[model samples]
Target: MSKGHDFLITVKAPGKLYIAGEYAVVETGYPAILVALNQFVTVTVEESNDYGTINSQQYKENSLYWKREGNNMVFDNRDNPFHYILSAVHLAESYAQSLNKTMKCYHLNIDSDLDSPDGKKYGLGSSAAVTVATVKALCRFYDLPITNDILFKLSAIAHLDIQGNGSLGDIAASVYGGWIAYRSFDREWLKKARNTFTLNKLISIEWPQLNIELLTPPENLELLIGWTGSPASTSHLVDAVGLEKAEKRSSYQEFLDLSKNCLFKMIDGFHNHSIEIIQKEIRINRELLQHLGKISNVEIETPLLQKLCETAENANGAAKTSGAGGGDCGIVVINKKYATSSLIKEWKKNGICPLNLHVHQIND
Candidate 1:
């Protein structure tokens, strides 16, 4: 293969799931710890005579092209993948400029493991990962003096532009790497705190560790199967909750309080290394999520997911939807004693595959 440029940069950004404190993170100013799953968005940037071209072999066969119009970059949205790529790169350039640096034009290839069906659930923040990866590639390509905080903030801005609303935690986790306690509700307070810690110092801080076992269906434990087939917009879901809050609904307040309690318990479980307690906390967390009305759609909790939850509960395993619910992946914490071959066979019979993800601290 002939090379197109002097340098090629590849960056991978991970997806995230909100284990606890989903709705509350936006309002109560609490920390949400999001796990970066193995699935990632990969970007390849190389110098080109063309202002920019984004190609995703997985999504589309043709390349999406963009040209620089003075200081602005423009793209055509007829091609969805290219539109997203162009938007991401433009944001990256803007981010570079904010750091008192310029971004050079390049041919960028953006790819993601976020395709429907085989891909992880739609709500796992794949778009955020792509934004982070694109920003990192632009930073590297231009040798811009962009810090992790800048990258995170820029990514959040891009996400808001792309999806209308997003939890900044996903972008923060991708840029900062590993586990992070992020609360962006009070930007002024956070902005002041950011001045006190350099990116290098922040990255060097030790994050708490917890043992995560990616369970093999049946051999490890029982799992629930749920598929709504209808894609749910995370922004719409959050908007619904926001309406409840604005209306002064007591249920909304109670759900927020429960989420806070769950967050505390989850943190305690992590700090104390108590798997049993963590499982209990997860159950409470799911219940609170359901009460918030985000998990109300029958499509969100598919018949399969409902069955799996019922089966898992009967088998001493707790199960719930992982992301925004509506037709995404489900999480199950099974008791080691009850994770038997019989349970595995039952799940396979229903076409529900279990992804056992192990949680470990990334020691830099």
Candidate 2:
């Protein structure tokens, strides 16, 4: 990277949607596929004269003043409305300091389109996107050389510190962008590394079993998304499933094995460019999630999500609930032979809002 200059630097990180392997992906080395959406969280950094300030358009109350105190950020507000951003800044600066880079006061601003105009989250991994954006923007502001791998590790650690639990495939999508086949590394390993290694050393080392691969969709396949107008808390749903994991260990292991098989088939479908195989695996993955929900006593698919999937099935498309679904969005995989016009119309009539979103690539 070139030397830092007194100029505004902005970075945009895209949000993500899970394609398959939701709950199972939480386990280390378990695979999942996720796509980065067109929606984004943007962060800009510029030099500041006085006390450093953090401003956010999506969260007005989160705007706060802070100052550096011996390499640590001292904030004026204690509520911490923007924990992810704050955590990202701290980690990025800490990494930069380890390299003997100078840290200066800068004003950070965030704007997001990952939510509705009314500030409703679209369940598109806004928190992860924001964390990635913040880290990327600060890296640029500090003139730090960073690759996508280093960025992913840095942003993942920052996000995980706040969230406490998640598969963090969304962080991979945000950092890498586009259609990515992801499997999370061991969080326990990360926790141990944090205590044993420095931020720079931690980022430099390879994370065990963390894999991310960009994928290309088959030429005949297309994707469609429908929002149920009800936002679901992924953390809560994951926690609920975690509670049942111990009692229903056998069932949970079955879910993991089945989900792994289903996702591998879908990935092979991608590699071979077989739309038929992909669609079939999509349906099978849906059934797996349903079985998981039943055994865990968690509603992975809500009534509206069920309606959405059935409507798509009637239109000759394969559909399933996306993410830790209680109520959120469902994804449909359709062949080019099937026109989505009638399916979208049916969704509208049933009160499900069809999202005009596409896969987001890093080059775009």
Candidate 3:
């Protein structure tokens, strides 16, 4: 622990769902909307004597015993389930060292509620949440002077080093909380800058083309999320789409243009507090994703997901797949005047699990 503070520090980061702009958001400067849900990954860190242990409630069999050898973590076991957490530890410690802070061994305990009782993923961004929570917990443990922006940058670098692609929009939602309009930073510039700049200097500098704006939803708008009972791999879907990006030149560009326009309109609806315009744009964006799936020959919306959307639309709500969408959850935007009980019952009949999640906001 730092001096007199010999207590445990715990931090929680909420999981996220992509509301709009999934594939297009992967490109730099393109915008996307995401929400932080009540589901969270919590990390707790405590000072240890000499060696430390990394344990998780979800992965009890994969607990790790580690010790610091001059700021490097040397684990006793080779099999590690905490890849993103370890990355976050290294990045945050590196930043601390850049400020001439000493490193110490600490026991880290992780707990999560982002999955089902049987351990099936619900398509929420658990990895990003875990990384963000770990980073935040370390910041508290080390008593580092960090803002949300600095925390986001460090977490993003840690995540990007592992995932290598995709927008860090999930990280933004985890960091800032609530509904956010986010644009990705330039990956090419970051790739080079990581090699040239020091950790502290890089985090302090502004990232190119990155933007995040918190938004307030219309008073009448109601958000509903339904799980398809099947988990989808976002990276696999992204990689599959990447193969077609080069082949379908004009079609891909057209998809990007239309998605950009639709998301902009939806963002405007949030600003103007118009539920009608927002729902209309949601329908349009869903169609755009359908076309993209066709061109890419990928199953963006599976049969079950299609049924989930159709049921919500029949209930006078606009719906679509929340993320990569081959499986996982779908989101609905409806007017609060309408009751979702019957609609949710119908969803249950079709094997769709309606998640009782609310928007999570950071009160800072």
Candidate 1 lDDT over residue span 1-364, tens digit each: 2346867988888776655556667663655555666667899999776577778756666776677676666765454654445556766776556566644557778777754546445565777778888878887777776666566655665665666554567776666654445554444443454467643343233322211222112233223333334456667776766766666667677777777777676677666656677678778877777766653322345566666566566667777766566555666666576654665566667766655444323332
| lDDT (CA) per prediction | 0.61, 0.92, 0.93
Q: Which ten residues in a row have the lowest lDDT in candidate 1?
A: 209-218
Q: Mind giving the per-residue lDDT tens digits that candidate 3 earns over 59-178?
A: 999999998898788999968888899899989888778877888888899999999878999989999999999999998888898899999999999999899888999999999999
Better of 1 and 2 by TM-score: 2
Residue-pair clashes, model 2: 0
RMSD to the hidden true structure, all candidates = 6.0, 1.6, 1.2
Instruction: Provide the clashing-pair count of each candidate structure.
Output: 10, 0, 0
TM-score of 2: 0.97
Model 3 residue 79 lDDT score: 82
Cα lDDT of model 2 by residue, 1-364, tens digit: 3333457898999999999989999999999999999999999998875578999997686688988877777888878688899899988998899888877888899999999999877799999999999999999888888999999999999999899999889999999988999999999999998999988889889999999999999998899999999999999999999999999999899889999999999999999999899889999999999998998899999999999999999999999999999999999999888888999999999999999999999973
CA deviation > 4 Å runs, candidate 1: 1-4, 76-84, 99-102, 116-122, 176-182, 187-231, 294-302, 335-341, 356-364
For model 1, give the RMSD to the true fold.
6.0
Per-candidate TM-scores read 0.77, 0.97, 0.98
